[model samples]
Target: MKRNSYAIIGSGALGGLYGGMLAKAGFDVHFLLNSDYQHVSEQGLKVQSTWGDFHLPQVNAYDNAAAMPACDVTIVALKTVRNHLLPDLLPATTREGGVVLVLQNGLGVEVESAAIVGEDRVLGGCCFLCSNKVGPGHIHHMDFGRIVFGEYSRQEITPRAQTICDELNSANIDAQVSADLGAVRWRKLMWNIPFNGLSVALNASTKEIVDTPSSFALADAIIREVHQGAAACGVDVPESAIAKTMGNTVKMVPYDSSMRIDYLNGRPMELQAILGNPLAAAKASGHEMPRVEMLYQSLQFMDKAAGK
Candidate 1:
């Protein structure tokens, strides 16, 4: 595969992890770092992951979309709460046939993004990693850093997705093209809805939540609710999926979820996208999501307190 120029939108955590690795692997990578633009320009990007510590010296970091170069591929790694803000960040580079890879958290991001950019140009992806920004130019990757991307609604897989998969695999990253992107996304969402929100609501870690009986039960219940909700949306998640996800979560080194981190940092939490989308699906499918509803209400209460 020929190397391609790549643009990263919302270059934080997952963005930094994937983008930094790609840049390190010698791809012509540019990052739209709106929040850390100035800092990255002055100091470059500092990524500290289990893989190693990397300081990118020649990276193209931009705050405004207008400053970015037209690219073959664009990765949308923004938090779900910031989905509405993406149209203004596209610049001219993302239009036409350029593939927009949605490597975001939450369930309906593909739909939301396809609504803005045409469905044909949008691809769905999920990052099987835990990472966050620790400082202006530094990202702390806490766990696995695999990135899986593929076609969502389009008939043939776009060239951009194929090229990216090749580059990522060449670099020893866990990257693959799945036939069912919707199922892949819903599978990830099934784990996030309960674990992420409940961690935030109780100010607890995954391990802590799992160790406590009441919290553990709550987490299990929320998992069941999310499974039913996915079924309502036509995604069938088996009963054992929750237990498997919990096992994976337990393997990660101790770290707080992005929701809890956002809550602590006084930023707007991503409760709406993380929990709201699935709950909306459940309601639309005429399924009751009492456990998810309670968790969503709890997040709302916390958001109000945070003035988000």
Candidate 2:
């Protein structure tokens, strides 16, 4: 079987871990990094994972996409806030007929990439990973590392999507294909909407939020509201999804969500992509998610205030 070359556009925590795994498996993987470019280029990438510790002495690291080789699979692991750069990066890093896999969180993420690469060549991935960049060239993988791939604007699992999943599994990253992109996205939001926002709103970790009855209840309420919002948008998310998210979160490592870490470091949270877009979708269907709307408003205020 032929292996697919990969380009990791954002070599942050999630990107670094997955890209590093691919590189460790001897696949052709190129990383386009920003702040960690110098460190990773000089010292290689380091991963401290629960599975085990590994180090790549050298990697294909570049500071810009133009300098990187075009690959069969171009993975966009960028924070949705920096998605504006996709117009420049996607065209530069993706080869003709290559697919663009979007690994960012929240709804409607694949739309921008699809517009650039064409719908048939766009894939959205819902990542269920708990990892963070602790330092330059270093990623801490605390727990959970599974990704569900879904074809954009389609409900069938394409062969290309399955092939990518096979490659990811070969690299020891648990991956599978989903027929319904919208459903998978909403299922991810079941956890993201509550935990990401509440982590920042209450200055709490996953374990803390789960341990506190009040915060946990609020999180549960928000999850149900998200379910309704998904239904309003014509997506059927199972009730078991709510229980599954909460159950898994309870067993999760006590860790800071990506949004919380961004807040602590004075960086912008993914307020628009994660919350604002979902709210808009719900409202478009003439259904309102009051709890979600409230959370979104609070996050908006917090994000703006933190900018000052």
Candidate 3:
């Protein structure tokens, strides 16, 4: 078996967890860090996972992409708001013929990546992860670490996609290859839309929102609207997905969403990618998600008011 070397573009919570797991499995993994560069370079990476706690004493850490070696696979885990850096980071860290896997949330995320790396060399990954970067060089994995990914523009699970899935599974990470990228992305949005948006809007955690009747009802309505929007865009998301998402949330440990964390930390939120793009797509398909649009506007207002 050919082991693929990996370049982790955003060495934050998601990137650190996945890349740390790969590195722990003995694959060559290069991490590109920003603010944590100094800390990680000196102390290495730390992972506090539900499965166990481990640390990599020595790691291939680089502060700049140009200083890192091009690798077989480049996993992008940066927030959507920082996607502007992909154009430079993708080409710099990806070797020729290598693929780029986007592990961020939202609809049409692969579009920009594909435009830079070509559609065939790009894959979209929908991550069901509950983890956070507690401090420099430290990641805390709470629960759920499954990734469903597929080619950006293809309907078949290509060999490249399967290979990545196999590698992830080998590292004890639950990974699966999907046949339809669009459908998978929309299905993931069934949870992201309500939980991520309402978490900040209502100033609550996943359990708080689910435990409250009014908030839970709002979340349910938003999920239905996302299902309608997906249908309008020619994607068939099963109606049963609504119950599944709600049930899953009800069981998940009380955790703060990425969006809520960003807002509370006074950082920019991913309004354009998460809300703006999906709303535009639905509107173009002659569907209107009123609840989603209202949430979008409210979030925008809050973001501006906080100067984030």
lDDT of 3 at 258: 92
Ranking by TM-score: 3, 2, 1
Model 2, span 120-168: residue lDDT tens:
9999988999999999999999999899988987899888998999989
lDDT of each: 0.80, 0.93, 0.93
Off by over 4 Å in 1: 155-160
Clashing pairs in 3: none
**What lDDT is obtained when candidate 2 is compared to the true structure?**
0.93
Q: Which 10 consecutive residues of model 3 have the lowest summed lDDT?
A: 107-116
- Kindly report the root-mean-square deviation of model 3 from the true structure over all alpha carbons: 0.8
The alpha-carbon deviation from the true structure for residue 102 of candidate 2, after best TM-score superposition, in angstroms, is 0.1
Candidates sorted by lDDT, best first? 3, 2, 1
Q: Which regions of candidate 2 deviate over 4 angstroms?
A: none
Report clashes for each candidate as comma-separated counts. 0, 0, 0
For 1-308, candidate 3 gives per-residue lDDT tens digits of 77899999999989999999999999899999999999999999999999688999889999999999999999999998999888889998999999999999999888878989998999998999999999999999999989999998889999888999999999888899999989989999999999999999999999999999999999999999999999999999999999999999999999999999999999999898789999999999999999999999999999999986
Segments of candidate 3 deviating more than 4 angstroms:
none
Cα TM-score of candidate 1: 0.94
- Taking all chains together, each candidate's TM-score versus the true structure is 0.94, 0.98, 0.99
